[model samples]
Target: MVGVSVLEDNLKDESLILGLLDRHPIGVAAVFKRKIVFASKGLARLFGWRREEMIGRSTRIFFSDRASWEAFGERLYRLLEERDDVVLEWPLQKKDGSPIICEIITRRLRPLGDDWIVLSTIRDITAEKRSLRRLKARSSSLRLELSGALEALRREKDFLRRIIDLVPAGIGVWGPKGPVLKNELLRGLLGENIPREIPHLVGRLIRGAGRVFRFEEEIQGRHLLFTLSPIDDQNILLVVEDLTSCVKMREGLETLAQAKASHLLSQERLALMGRLLAGLTHEINTPLTFMKTNIQIFGAYVEGLRRLLEGAELAGEKRKTIDKIISEIRDITKSLEMGAERIAEIITSVKNLGRKESFNEEIDLGQALHEALILTHNKIKHHLRVFINGEPYNRQKGVPLLGVYTTGRRSLLVQMMVILINNAAEAAQRRRVKGATLEINVEDIYPRVVLTFRDNCGGVPEEELSRIFESFYSTKEEGTGLGLYILKEIVNSLEGTLEVECPKEPEGLLFRIVLSGGGGGVERIFNKTFYKGVQDGHQGIGTG
Candidate 1:
């Protein structure tokens, strides 16, 4: 009875341990002679088999090949003998023939049998193996990306260094300890002798001492503009630009401008002198004309008197007295003739003074007159009423004048018109003529074009009229009395004449200009008339 109870107790303990092993999370199995004798539900589920189907099956069925299965069994058994337990990770096959990785923990068991058995705990580690493989692939990808980024960064650093070296402006980085980086330009500017003050300047710049330090300094006889800019807490950028050429160029330009201004002033003075000389010459010509004419008449009369006295038959004393008187009269006549001839030479010289000799060119006198009128529009536009007769040229309207062409200096003609128009304006203003009318007529008379300037300003007194051509004889408050004198000289220069008529009849004062005409042909384009306060905002200018 005692033996039977002991054996039953032993059987009960074995059954309880087997129940706990079957309920574990991992697969459990017992193998004997390469055949599965016991298999937990977990092991059967892992192999996609039922417990009943796997329990009696050979372990070889779970292996893809017989050699691998045998090798695993032998390794497991040999390792289990040396250690308490043997662990192995192996490639295995499921019941459906799919490959998997498994971790098997095994121990050798000696039961009441001659054959050896192994109790194994298996866990399917396939998911964990796949995760590990993915992690390894990601590590490789990250390594490649890191290598490419490092190469790109190196290239960028090299490109920036090359740019700094090649720039024209001197560039340097200065820190508290002085220059930390210097480009080629900066090195050349510094040369072998760096100033002792540079380190102090750099120290001040690094501490943010001022807004921007910029000044000029001479280095090696070359003027340079140095600028220091703060870059960071400990460093600053120093830049230098050469300004020697710019200063020299500016000085040269100033000197040239001054010389040009002086030349212009000299030219203007010469022009004024020429105008005065021309007026003086005209004043002298008028007196010479009358002197020559009267002298010739008086000479003829003296000859007639001498002939009559000789034929009358007088006594000795009376005849002697008469002959002496006749001789005195002849001497007086000879003196007058010689004096007039001497004055004539002086008049010729004054006329040609400061006058530039130029070849005559053909120009439309009417056109030149129009240009002069436009230039003097401000002087006459508001004060006087002006009317022009003839085919007038309007530059704005593209209308040209007729056959009023003349062979002369256009500049001289234009100047003459300016003087006449201004004189007329002054006269009108002086006389205070209401509804003042100044008429201008340009007519082509075959070989000559006659231009007339008539003004309704009160006529000059008879005494003043004769002296109008005299220099320094003016009727105006501001006049230098050279206007009419200059006008006469201009006419004479062109081989033309200026005539005046003042009878107070149809017009107040009449002045005529006659010029020789020469051009290819004649084209009578348009006629224009201008009146004061009539055509406002109109550009065409004319007077009749």
Candidate 2:
């Protein structure tokens, strides 16, 4: 009886242990012959079921599919045979037909009532598994991208190396340690022997990368120009070029330019001297004209006084002595007047050769030409008879020039006219023909004032005509060759045109000057008579 009581106590202890396993917080279950005989409350909760509902259910009921249940069983049995316990991740289901991933640990238990028992501990691991799957997929994608990037980088590096190698200029790339890349051109420059201090030179170049560095060195008996530039913090590039041929060509060009510039400066200085002479003559002639006129008046007064003294009744001796004195006084006054007139004429000739106009103002073409003729009278009066060939007068356009008015720097036009008149005079003197004439015609031709100078001088050669307007080109002895050239320039600056008609039908040269002004436009005076009451004998004009 005591033995039976001890056996009952052992049974009681076994029951107590089983009860504790059923109430565990984790899902703990005891399976006998693949059937659930005991299930913990935790296990029932994990499957969304009551403990009593799972107690008598087949373990297959907890698997989502028959294939999964059989596969898990096979794996569990194989693993259990090798070890005391096996853990597996599986899709578990509940009574409500919902699914979850679970971590299941199965261990072999002692045989109970002739059936083998397997104890299993189950926990939901769905969240961790899903995260793990995502992480694995991301890692695989990243690995593929990295592989492609690495291949593309290698191809680009190879292509860049090939291109840099083919360039004609010597190229070298230096890294922190030393030269990392170099082209064939650089190798040729270095030749069979490399410099010992090249590494130091590269180091200095890298440190001074903020600015460019240049050094000259003789290699293979050829002068080489080396330039160093920075690529980045740790890399620098060096380029070498040969400039021996280019330097010779540049020096030759510079020498030629200097010679041409010197010739131009000489011509310019000569022209300036001519202009200065013209200005000095004009300034002197203005005052000299009054001086000559006053002297002439004083001579006339002396003559009148002599006559009055001669009319007086006096003794023979007194009359003879007084008359001699009066005669001497008259001769002296006449000589003084002649000297003044000569001075005026000399100044007028110089004036035409040296003056420049500084500012523009409205001027009447007729009056301007008339004044120019007076100033150049001494130069042309003997060889040429000149006249304006137009109507008597027009108050608005200035008399004899009828309806011709223009705006320009007055002194420039006057000086140009003087040059043209003097040229005509010279041409006539060369002809040696008496009564050689030059005619000036001013016309208002629709928004322009046209001044034509026609002379009876023998024409210039056809070949020479083309070059007459060029500076330093002359057709006469003592000619400066700047007259026509300067005239052309002034006309151009005034927005005017100058043209020549050489060897025209009448056997004379004609110069035409067109300036931009004729009473605003021709339409303004369309109905007005251009040359009213004109007369004859006003044909050719000339320059001395």
Candidate 3:
């Protein structure tokens, strides 16, 4: 009877221990040979299975796949052989197959025959791990943002430093406590001899009611202008300029003004000569007209004489002599007629020089180029080949479909073109280049027109190009030196810009003229292939 009572008490103690373990927060299980021998209520709740159902079930039921189950078994057994306890985090599955992260701790319970019993405690850590991962990602993002902001600030600082360094005058920035920034010029200007009272003066200026202060000082025989400007309540900007060189510069400018006045006088004389030449051309045109008419009448008289002789009977030698005399007279009349025509063309070209009237006319640049080509034909006929927008120039075609127009005087533009063409011809002749080429391009870039004249006459040296437009500057011995200067003035009067460059290929000078007040008449122009050589074969020029 006493033995039976002891057995009942021991059973009660065992039931009490099991009941306490069932109410624990962690899931607990005991396994033998990879099969669960005992399971607490918490273990069944963790896996969504009843405690009775979990007991005697294989531990594989808690794993989502065979690989994980086998891996865990291998690691667990390997660790158990070395130590009594092992802790790891692994993936587990619920009764519904939902995945979860679990922190598992296992301990060797005891040995039973050939296999060992193990006790395991599992706690779900999915939510905690997710929170940690999110925190790490947010931290990384913040670090990048902070890095970007710092880099931006560094660049801004460098930009400000570069700007201040570029200033010719000494610059300094002062804060409430002391100087916050000083440029290199400022450091050199102040150097060891900086006045002790300057900082005090700045402080006083900062506290004053005025927004700005200016004064002049002489230190170490250097004349300096000082300006203090308040940036805000706590900061002030200081600028120092040395005025010793400025006084000398003013004197130099006065001398330059005198020289410029002399230059202006020369230009005024040139203008007077131009007007005189215009009047001379007008006076000569009257006599030139009469001379051309008389030449034509003389040609008619010679033809009548030849017909009279043809009707008369004469000896063979006498007839031959009379025929030779008639033919010579006819040839002389033709030469006289040609001379009069050439004189007329020269008069017309002179009259067109720098004409200022009709300044508001809508001028077609292509037409102006054609007229200029006619005026310069004699000058370029022998050696030069000219292309208009990459096509050979044809006198008969007359630059058709160019479609580029601008608001300017047609005569003035023609004169400008004439000057440039004559200049290129002279350059080619001077260089004695065989088969020289000049390319003229007119482009309409919307509200602006670009006229380019490029010549392969061996461009001038780079240093000489800048002085080409200066008064009394010429690259040739016989050049009057006023052609390019006058061309530049004409362009300026039309409110346009001119640029000169030396082309790398073809080795020539390129003159680019950009003019405003331009409009396009067609979507495209100059779309044809023009062969070299004139139709009459007199000049190697064409137009398209």
Candidate 4:
């Protein structure tokens, strides 16, 4: 009866323990020789299986694969032999073959002959592990972001420091207690003992009175402008600017401007004097013309009287008297003629001093060239073959093929063109070159007109070319040297540029003239007039 009661008591204890294990939140299982010998209801539910199905099942069935099962078995047995319990986190499979992460704690319950009985508790930790991974990733991202922000802030601070150092003016910042920051300029201006030197100013700034103060002072012989401004309730900004150089520059500029004004006034007076002289010369030319004509007539009369006396039969005294009268008249007339001629030459020499007229006229450069060619035909016809805008010069055509226009006096432009052509022809004659060709091109590069005169007449010496436009600087024996100089003056008056170049390949001189072009409105008017003239069988420059 006693043995029976003890057996019943042992069975009841085992049942009560299994019932408690089943009721536990964690899964519990017992494994002997790598097979489940007992499984709690919690264990079966953890693996998505019935308790009856879990019992007598191999531990490999709970593992995802054979490799994991073997690895777990090796670790489990190795750790069980060395310690009381083994704790591991492993990926396992449920009854549906779905994956789960589990934290397993196994203990060696006892030794059953050659094998050992082990009790294990399993906890599904997939969600917890996933949450922990997310937290780790978030922490790493935040760390990276914070590090980038700090680096950027550091770079920004360095940039601001460099900017502050580069500022030309002295800059200082003051806090409530004392000076907070000072740039290099400020340090050099105030020195290290800034607080002691400017105690009153520092006290005022520290008061943070919301008023701006500005003053100028001479410190160490340097003029400086000081501006004190409140930045906020706790800080003040001070800007110091040195004005010594500025004051000196202003004085210098004022003096220079006065001198420049005086110079311009003198130039204006001189220009006025030149205009007056030109006008006087013009007035003198009118009388000189009549005087010259009268002298020629009187000289002709004297010559006739002398011829008659030589042919007449007369007494010696009468003949001598006639001869004396004729000689006296002839000498007087010759003297008068020579004087008039001298005055005329002087008038021509200073012709450029005269104020230019008809400057408002829009002159067709091509027409100007055509007129100039006609006027100079006698001089250049024999030797020079001129091409106007790439076409052979035809004097009979009257009008050039190209019609580039610019704003200038027609007469002056014609005169300028004449000078260029005559110069080119003379140069060609001097060189004595065969097939001396002169190419005159007009290009309408909008807003400007470019006229190019290229000639195959041996160019001038390099040394002489630079002084070619100087007054009285001539290369020819008979040249007055005023042609190119006057040409330059005319070009300057018309606001144009003249450049001379001597080419090596063709061995000739090139003259490039650039002038403001008559705009589209003027061109349209020109075309209209040109076509109208063509219909009327008239060929010439269009009237404005």
Q: How many backbone clashes does candidate 4 have?
A: 0
Q: Each model's TM-score? A: 0.31, 0.39, 0.46, 0.34
The lDDT per prediction is 0.68, 0.67, 0.73, 0.72
RMSD of 3: 23.8
**3 versus 4: better lDDT goes to:** 3
- Sort by lDDT, best first: 3, 4, 1, 2
The collision pairs in model 3 are 393-542, 393-543, 394-542, 394-543
| Model 4 poorest 10 in a row by lDDT | 146-155
Model 2: per-residue Cα lDDT over 1-544, one tens digit each: 3222332433345444444444444587777678776677778788887877776677888988899899988888888778875768788887788888887877665555664567677867676567967644543343333223322223245433443443346766666797766777788777655554456666776677345567776777657777665665566666677655666678878976875686589779978987786676767777777877777787788778877987789999998898888888788877777576556545653553344545567665654675577667666767887767634222122334244668877767777888898889888887785777788888777688888988878879898898999876898888767788888988888889999988666677899999977864333222232322233233211111
Q: Model 2: which ten-residue window has the lowest total lDDT?
A: 535-544
Candidate no. 3 TM-score: 0.46
How many Å off is the CA of 35 in candidate 3?
A: 82
Query: Which of the two candidates, 1 or 4, achieves a greater TM-score against the reference?
Result: 4
Q: What is the lDDT of residue 425 in candidate 3?
A: 92
The top-ranked prediction according to TM-score is 3
Shift in Å, residue 519, candidate 2: 3.8
